[model samples]
Target: MPHHDGEQNGRGLSFAKRIYLPRTIGLSVGSVCVAVALYPLPWMHWIWAMLVMHAWVWPHLAYQRARRSSNPYKAELQNMLGDSFAGGIWVALMGFSALPSVAILAMMAMQNIAANGLRLLWQGLLANLLGAVLGFVLFTPQIQLASTPEEIYACLPLLVIYPAFIGWMGYKVALKLSEHKHVLSRLSRTDSLTGLINHGTWKDLLQVEFTRSQTLNRACCVALIDIDHFKTINDRYGHIVGDSVLKALSQALRDNIRASDLAGRYGGDELCVILPNTDLDLAVGILERLRQIVENQVDALLPELRISLSIGVAPYEQHIVDAASWLNEADKALYGAKSTGRNRVVSAPCTRADFQGLALGV
Candidate 1:
């Protein structure tokens, strides 16, 4: 199941990358437009065209950044506001240089309103609208001082619409990018089979828990659980039956464990459970109940088949500094339980002297 999830997560990341590439291209184009607008040339018409193009492309850049950052809505909002603010500042700097492009700006704003949801569109529209009004108030007088009414009228539309249009575009792009990145992130952390954390994820979580335990001086227990006679069942009943058994056992473990507990499949026939702030005794009691649940549930799928689990538990101590060392101790106890006879729980020997006499290798 973990393997299956890994495959899905890989695919999701691939898809996200595909979506991101186009947004990057769009941002590059917007950057080019900004450069062109800043250049000194007798290219007012061309500058207006580039400004409109920039407005069209700007929203997507924010969207893509937000997706990569894993916060789509906030990214979109930032993109929208950023574009409007940039446009307002650009007009102010260029002496209201591109005020005649309001129609194009309004069109871009409308596109944003349509592409994003109605609520987002409304928010974007309101923001851009304020920006548009502000740009006109701040720049039109400058236009009056430097150019004729016809020239000012020609530039007025660009000033009024560009800020709002760019703002809306930026937001729309950010949302799409964020959604893609979020899906990829979720796929990476989740196991394919049972929608639980994978082995790697479990290890990472254990390390974190270990650190917390050490810092707070809290007790933590690690349990190594093995499905009894799993190989014999797989050989006799087929791999499909083996898979069913694994799934059934996993569900039972999840159902019986607390929300704070971390349960993950370690490999083919082994599962590990990390119980935070739990002592050896508490962990033993939980595993015993889990063993009974597994035994009872196995009968529902294969009545003739008798399945059981052997559990070994080890409590984290001040002396046990590393997660690996703690896991090894639990594993030794697990092996002891299996060797003594399966379907039993064994607690780890606490003292070094106790372990020295036993030939237990985890």
Candidate 2:
């Protein structure tokens, strides 16, 4: 089973820093080399050229960083920056192929642009085309002055093949980087034994759901479930069997829940379900069916197995205003059901204030 760490947009900054720092340093050194080689060019020309290229890039970098940090305008900023960065890289690469003395400077500009928008394939293609054209133009003087037709023909392959080779390498590198990031992300959020969202992930998701529900006035429900006699199962059949039971139960919960609902392993023998756009009654009905399914399976396998669940359901907004309070209410109700004897669903208890002056007048 795959392990996942909790979801955090910029959580792997340290790892990202480690990977990018060397590349950044390498690019920086290469840029310095380009500046030295282009020393024969006027200083003002060099500075202005660099500035023009960077002007198109810095905003894209800022936008990318902001998007990774979960800025609200991420999608729009991403699209805008993606296009700008790709165009910039293409132009810079073309300039480098045309002017070898300033190749380092052009490489630097291309690197910066590529770092932010390499995910955009169309942009990369445009950059490669620009580079190929610049390469042809820069080498044309030599081709034109060639003593033999063969000499001119010999340069044809380089013009046709080099840019394509470079673009392919760039694409491969991007794919590898994406795969690594994906592995790291999965490692951050998944529980190993149960194959469900871990406790930390659950909390993070709950907060997001709560905020969305509050802002959109959408209904949501939280259900807390505890496996009855879980400790006894572990004691009687060994921890391995107990773990298997937990994994099976987790799959059952996930299969039973709606696509929008999130099920998580909260702690030992305690699982949680978050039902977006669901009322308390709907949540209860779902859990009740889940309980029946689990009960039937357990009975069939271990005929004497007395496994059951105690569930607590609470509606968002109507029951509690915030995630913490909502979870607390469901937990309290779960405890109530457990105390009464398991295998039952209970609604969260309303505060005395909520009962409001209406006494039983018998």
Candidate 3:
């Protein structure tokens, strides 16, 4: 495949490095096979020297060429195609001896397919066929399908080692992909600023907790929290300090809550929590403690600034229709807290008369 020079350079270098060891081992072992097959032939001494150079020297040359190229991946691909071409030439030089020739060509095909899938495999095959035709024309070698014991023995190492190398490479790629997938998944579900679960994910979890409470007849509470006078803080101290306030509040929530509690950033300067297996009184106690912790925070950078939370808690009720109703109750309680006094916690009322009294800020 074609690659742009700038983007592919580092990737190309990695590709070349990955290929280097396998190329060295495969060629070194393959040379033995070719040498054995050529034993009975009356080829010139230069042919023997060329075989030695191809086995011992060519892998290093290919690596150096790819490393120097601007597009290393493309360069490595060309080097691999060259490997196929050289294998074809060796097969022809060995007079088309069946076992060793088939071994070399099959391993080359396997390498190409593993590297870049079908496209590289087909390209390598074409290059190999062309090299075979050229070699046949140059040397006019006699075709010999039968393979001797010496040729088979020489082919053994290549067959055993190269496949294990390919398998290991595949495993490394898979492991790296899985790690990246987890990181991406976490990033998607978390708030970048507060490092808490984001708004949508928290809402999804609220529904899940609500369903569990309904099915298991368990106690749970939902809390909606907002920073008191957050807009004033942002205007007075700027967004940077405001962000610090939010982070500090989140830290307070994280530190004070049980491990089972789920906290999230609901929106700008607003947060939420799900307290599973907790009644209204316990939820109030937990959030009130969180509020005191945030209110007591002392920042060396912004000493004059103080932070407080307005929180509303709604306990799960059998009469609550769905997760949305429960969240709405918590939201109403939060509104009451902010409306009456900005730095207090308000619990949702059970009766309609109490709800009306809360709505009127009585």
Candidate 4:
């Protein structure tokens, strides 16, 4: 019988607030139905007074009681059970007249199930039964199954409006849950530091893109980017500054690339991008712009830092066997960029012979 987060210990105010308005509405409408049904009977004057207090005063008193309690969630649960007990007592007082009694029990059951599912529902039912039995034994209430037309009319608001309101509440909860699930899904696939697609997710997308490119005979390129002298930068000016450098590069890629381009943090001090519907020249241009942006903007943003990028880009070649070989070509070009000069973009053009040579480790 797990409850919602707001129902957890020390979250009393939230739990209390959630139940208060609904209780107020249900009890208020319910009071009308009970008063109408019992109007012709010669019940004690105090019974009428008790009905007035229960209808008008109880909702507010219950809210304050739960709000002030050590555990508002638990207190609210108790309050709901108390509501069920009182509902049963109302049924007995009305001589078990059909419409009002059914309205009270149905609303109670709905709330109970909504609060904590089947577990709380059964508890509420038992509480209702106990209250009815006690009322019958003490008061010797007359059993009148028939309801007057006026009494049926009085129960109508509770029957119609209350359930509709409860349905609306359930709908709101469902929407919140959907939003939470979407957030979680994105978080799982994203790099927390860079806010880009993570390595594994990006790799998965690369495979899918590879298949699509082969099927559609469309152009696509993959770029492997490394932060030039990243280790030296970290050694000179702590990890915090190093982190800023990575974020700067990531931001530059986001700002410069097309909407369809996918950028990801591949690993330490290295990032990758998947440029769909792009050729070698277009990919190089995109990376060059990103490189210039990082070089120019980073110093202004973080005065203590001056950053540069080394990028390797490889376009999809018909001869390339798989995504791994294509990525390897980009990796090789990236290595060439790093070996020759720090801030440069290198393109690896793979031919059938190059692919065969790579496969043969020649």
| RMSD in order of candidates | 12.9, 15.1, 2.8, 4.1
lDDT by residue (1-362, candidate 3, tens digit) is: 44455557877798899899889988888788899999899999999999999999999999999999877888899999999998889889999998998889998998899888999999999988988999999999988889999888888887888788878888898999899999999999999999999999999999999999999989999999999999999999899888988888888889999999999999999999999999999999999999998888888977888888899999999999999999999988887787666799999864445656865867
Once superposed on the true structure, which residue ranges of model 3 sit more than 4 Å away at CA?
A: 1-5, 350-362
Model 4 stretches with alpha carbons more than 4 Å out = 1-7, 10-12, 298-304, 350-362
Sequence-dependent TM-score of model 4: 0.91
Whole-structure CA lDDT of model 1: 0.67
**Model 2 bad stretches (over 4 Å):** 1-149, 299-301, 350-362
- Model 2's lDDT to the true fold? 0.63
Candidate that would win on lDDT: 3
| TM-score for all models, in order of appearance | 0.56, 0.57, 0.91, 0.91
lDDT score, candidate 3, position 100: 91
Report lDDT (CA) for all predictions: 0.67, 0.63, 0.90, 0.88
lDDT of 2 at 166: 42
Quote the lDDT for 98 in model 1.
Answer: 45
> Candidates sorted by TM-score, descending order?
4, 3, 2, 1
lDDT of 4 by residue, 34-125 (tens): 99998998899999999999989999999999988867888999999999998888888889999888899999999999988999999999
Q: Comparing candidate 1 with candidate 2, which one achieves the higher lDDT? A: 1
Residue 36 CA error for candidate 4 (Å)? Answer: 0.9
By lDDT: ranked, best first: 3, 4, 1, 2
